[model samples]
Every structure is written in C-alpha cells, then in structure tokens.
Target: MTAKFIVIEGLEGAGKSTAIALCQQFLTSQQIEFINVREPGGTPLAESLRDIVKAEHQESVASETELLLMYAARSQLVHNIIRPALAKGKWVLGDRHDLSSQAYQGGGRGIDRTTLQTLSAMVLKGLQPDLTIYLDIDPVIGLARAKGRGTLDRIEQEAVSFFERTRARYLELAESDERIKTVNANQDIAAVHRDITQVLEYFFQGLN
Candidate 1:
C-alpha cells in the first residue's frame, strides 16, 4: 500500500484523541506501519510553538502573530516528521493539520481566507492529507465538555461565538472537499467509532 496521510480535525472536546487512538488500533490490526503526530507538535521546535500558542500570555497575542507561528510549526512538522515518515513508506496519522488553521485563524479570528490559503500553500507545498476525518459537534456542547475536563488553554478559552464560527467554517470546507469525511461526534462514543470504522473500511477499499 502507498503511504497515506490521515488527519483528524475538530473543535475542542470533539473526541479527536479518542478517534486517533482508534485509528492507531485499526492500523495496527492491519499491520500497517504508521506514525502518529499532532499539529504544532511532533518536533522539538514545533512543540515549543505549540506551548506559546496555548499559553496564556500577559500581552495580547496578535492574530497575525498567531497565524505565522502556526505556519512555522507546521513547516517544521512537515519537513522534519510527516514527510520523512511518508518517504520511509510509513503512514502518517495526524491529530490536526492545515484545516485547523483555516477554521481557527481564518474563521474564528476572522482573518482573510486568502491569506491563510496562501500561507498554507507555501508552507505545505501541495501536501495534503489523503483522508481527513472531521468530527462534527455543536460548539456549546463541545466547550462544555472541554471545561469539565480542566482549565481551558488560551485558544480553548476563546468565546463560544468564536467556536461557532470555527465550526461553521469546518463544515463548509468539509462539505466542499471530497477528501474530508464528516462524522457526527455528537453521537455516543461507540456509535461514533462505528461510523469511523465504516469510513475507514470504505477508504481502505478504495485504496485497493
């Protein structure tokens, strides 16, 4: 099988972690060689950027600054981790990717979509996930789940309206993209996994 990149994207508390774990198990069962990674992470420099982005800063972080930092981190992860793993014929499973920036910065922060697209094209250089599993959920419920888990991070602490916009962008993009598969994460855990399993099976069938 050709090496493929799979990404899971969604708002906070959308069960991305659990979905990723499920993918890992599925890949393991199929004896597929794969590496799991998270956006703004999976590399030393990228991890640092993740910290800065998530940290509560005394000085307000400018939207442009945050956008640049996200690209920088993505550049590192793509160059140092994702591409290399794919080159070695290993599948790459990601917790998030370019779409997150489009939704969070472009939609939530109300940045220009063209700017975000230009940055993504430059940094990614045509690289894109073979499959993107988008866990869809209401912002209100998702935010509540996140709050119940623990203290929210800088991005997670954004207003509910911000997430509402983010979710809207996510759905809009997913609907237009053939590579993206939208799953109803509002369903019970087992039901969600069953749907994910169905998606993966269909994707695998297409691969063959």
Candidate 2:
C-alpha cells in the first residue's frame, strides 16, 4: 500500500494529544510503519522557529510575520522530514499542519486569505494531508483545560474571542473539505478515543 499522510488539528486543549496517541495505537495495531511529527518542528531549524513563534516577546509580533515564519518552518519540515519519510514508504502523522494557519492566522488574526494561499502553495508544493482529524471543542472549555496544563503560550494567551473565531474557521473549512474529518472532543476521554477509532477504521477501509 502507498504511504499516506495523516494530521490531527485542533484548538489548544482540544485533546489533540490524546487523539494522536489513539491514532498511533491504531496504526501500530495494523502493523504499519509511521513517523509522527509536529508542525513548526520535526527539523532543527523548524524547531527553532517553533520556539520563536511560541515565546512571548517584548515587541508585538506582526501577524504577517508570524504567518511567514510558520511557512518557513513548514517548508523545512516538509522537505527534510515529511516527504522523505513518505518516500521511504512510512506513513507520516502530523500534530498540526497548514490548516492551523488558515484558521488561526486567517480567521483569528484576520490576515488576507490571498497571502495564506500563496504561502501554502509555495511551501506545500502540491502536497497535502491525505486525511485530517479535527478535534472540535468549545473555546471556553478548551481554554480552561489549557490553563490546567500551566502557563499559556503566546498564541494560547490570546482572548477567548480569538479562539472562537479560530474554531468557527475550523468548522467552515472542515465542512468544505471531505478529507478533513471532525470528531467531537468534549466527550469523556474514553468516548473520544472510541470516536477516533471509528474515524481511523473508516479511513483505513477507504485505503483498501
């Protein structure tokens, strides 16, 4: 079977980590070889970019600048890690991808869609996730969960309204894209995992 790229996307504290773990288990059970990576990371340079993007800065960071930095990191990750793994016939699982940018930067930051599309076209170079599982949750609940983990990052520190816009955008895009699957993440942990299993099994069947 040809290798596939899968991604998990969600707002902060939407249980993406848990969902990703479930996906990993599912893949392992199927005896599939895969590598997992996170966006703005997976390579030395990209990891550095991740730090810059996450760290609080004295000066306000421009939205456009943040968008550009994200794409640069994504470019490095795609060329150096993602594509290479797929070429070696290993499935690639991503913690986040360009859709995060489209939702966060475009919807939350109100950046121009044209700019985002241009950057994505340049970096992705026709590559896109074969499947994306978007864990959906209310911003209020998600933010409370994020706070429990510790201090919030720069992006996570944004107002709840920001995440509301981001969530709206996520749902809008997910509805329009068949490759993106929405999974309710507000349920009990076990219930969420069960839903994730169903999503994965459906995706696997499609593969055959």
Give the TM-score comparing model 2 with the true structure, all chains together: 0.99
Residue pairs of candidate 1 with colliding backbone atoms: none
Q: How many clashing residue pairs appear in each of the predictions shown?
A: 0, 0
Please write out the lDDT profile of model 1 over residues 100-206, one tens digit for every residue: 99999998999998899899999999999999999999999999999999999999999999999999999999999999999999999999999999999999999
Where model 1 places Cα greater than 4 Å from the true spot, the runs are none
In candidate 2, list every pair of residues with a backbone clash. Answer: none
Give the true-structure RMSD of model 1.
0.6
